[model samples]
Target: MEFTCISCGNPLSESDLELSINLGSAASMEEDVDLSGDESPPFALDAIDDSETMNFYSTMCTNEPMAESSTEAMPLCERCFESLAGSIIHDIQRTTRETGRYNEAIDQLSTVTPPPPPDLTALELEESQAMAEFQSVQAELHKLRRTLAEVRAEAEKTTADTEERWRAMNEAQREADAACEAARLHAAVSTNLTAMLASLREDATLALFPIVDCGTHATICGITLSSNDWAETGAALGVVAFLISVLQKKLDIFGQFTVSPQGPQSTIAIERQGKSTQVYPLHMARPTKKGAVQLGMACCCLLHTIAEVYVAQFPDDDAVSFERDGHSVDLDDRSESAESRRPIDAINGLSVVPEPRGAPSERWDLSWREALLCLGRVCRSTATLDPG
Candidate 1:
């Protein structure tokens, strides 16, 4: 007869049928004995489906037979048979583990005693005391906060008062500084006015000298001039040269000609094209024609420089000018005429010609007096004094 699985209705292989027949034989051998009489069932039927293989195993282990006509209905495919066997083995292992755990729990219960319950009264008292301390601490914290607020308010008031005092002090300091500055300015103005008055007095005194005396009877530094007295004339000329040098320095005049005064031995330097030519001994023991001519030329050059300075200061005024024979005394004038003859002939009566012999001292004194008169006019104009 053909055999098939009762669970899935699939034909069973020969090896499956052979394994089932061996299990049946083993079940028959144990039919007379009770395999599960003294202990619980090893496999749990609830753990697997109630399939035909399960039912077959259950009946065989209990020594129960199926109906005669349905004896072969217990056949199963290999897959269903393996699944059912695995479920039965898993249920057996789980039962063994549960039994072991129950045995361990029983052994521990017999060896150990249970602990007593806690005391509720002492615990309740401790909780109440802890709550009371917390309340006290909270009250102290509130009191400290109030004290801190009061201290902060006092500090703000003190700071405001300090600021007011500082502002007042600063304002006073500013007023004092302003007063000092005003006093300093007033003192400075007073000093400047005093200095100006003194300078005016000195200039007034200097204007009274006889150096600028342009009359027919001229005197030099209180000494009268004579035609024959060479010594007196020479000394007068030295004084004139010294005065001219002083005037040049006072006016801050600088140019091609520079004069250095040493009574009777004064010198004059003429610079042209960066070359300097010096003439010395403006006053000699016995004046020669050549010496007189050179002295005259030097005086003309000095006068020319002074004239230029005066013109610069008073560009519009033409009252006082240095001229000789109707021509201005210009040292650079190189034309052939009376203009060229200067500065040698710029001063009148200085040269002693052979045809009409004249006293050289007298001529020198006249020329120098005229030059000094022109210088006095310049000084007065610069000082804002009366030229007369």
Candidate 2:
């Protein structure tokens, strides 16, 4: 057989039925196994050569009880042998029908053999031509059936390949989705639980409130800059001053050098230029909503001078504000209320506008801390040191 049936995977053999019966149905076990791990073939079978006649014969096979199953004079096992016999009979009958049809087709073709050339009748010639044409049409029909079968096989293979790819893609997507979900859940748990963790021993407690540093308010960075520590605020401020001299640049030439603050309790430090002075308030008293990076040199200088006065007595938190939006009288025109230029009355036991700076800041060689100590000796009472 040139091909195997896809459904049954069996051989449609060349053996003729007439010869099959002559052999008396000798069943030989071919011992085939399906390596593809699918179901077994439906039947066991055998083949015989044609002898032009058909008949059947059978001989029972039995093992004598005394004999061992060895290679000495033995017949096939009955179960296997019987199964083979049945399949052979079926094959014979099937082939008989097929062969009969094949022969009739041949007989029909042989009936009108091409007549000897030139039989003078035109009608006879036409009949012979018609037969050739009919034969050609039958040949083409057979070819078409074979081509259609091949096309169907190819289409089925493509469909199976596409389905396999689609399944693999879906599996990959599911794996990715699972991984992303795991990461998201992990992040949520960390965010929710981390607050319960304790802070380190050296850490300082602060509200972490967003605050602004201004003339009145001091910040940690500002304190560090002014502490006479390495990169001391006094020196840094001087360096900034030197750069300002060289660059001759201004943030806003017409604008005041003050910055707005956004919080009520921010802290700040001050260091003056050309003078060694460092000071810090206990807390910053401005909000952070309106804040800016002050020109360190000028701001530090202004703050140091003011701090020298307030270091003895300070102003109430809201001592000075430039805004006069609600007033029609201008302090500039001197048409404002008589009290506009004057300091308000006492606040929290502190007086206002203590005094103008004594003589600009003295150029001192002592550290700011040392300077504070000398001043403290000159004036006792923390209350007097802070006039606020």
Best by the lDDT measure: 1
Q: Backbone collision count in every prediction?
A: 0, 24
TM-score of each: 0.33, 0.20
Q: What 10-residue stretch in candidate 2 is worst by lDDT? A: 251-260
Best by TM-score: 1
lDDT of 2 by residue, 1-388 (tens): 2532222334323342222322223222232333355543343232334322111322222122212212222233334434656866687779869999999999999897786877568977898899999999999999998999999888899888888888888888888888888888888876764442222112311111111123322223224222313234444344323222221222111021122121222223333334554433311122122211112222332333222223223234232222222232121222334344221111111222232334433222123223333333322333244331
Clash count (model 2, backbone only): 24
Q: Write down the RMSD of candidate 1 (Cα, Å).
A: 23.0
For candidate 2, what is the lDDT? 0.36
Off by over 4 Å in 1: 2-73, 76-90, 102-116, 182-388
- Residue range 1-388, candidate 1, lDDT tens digits: 8876766777878987876665454434443444555563443343334457555665543234543223333465678767867777886678769989999999999999778887899889998999999999999999999999999999999999999999989998998898899889878987996686456434422222232222122344555322134566456555445444444443443343455554455544443433455343345344665445534444444444344444454444444434454444443344668544433333232332112246664344433444433334433344343232
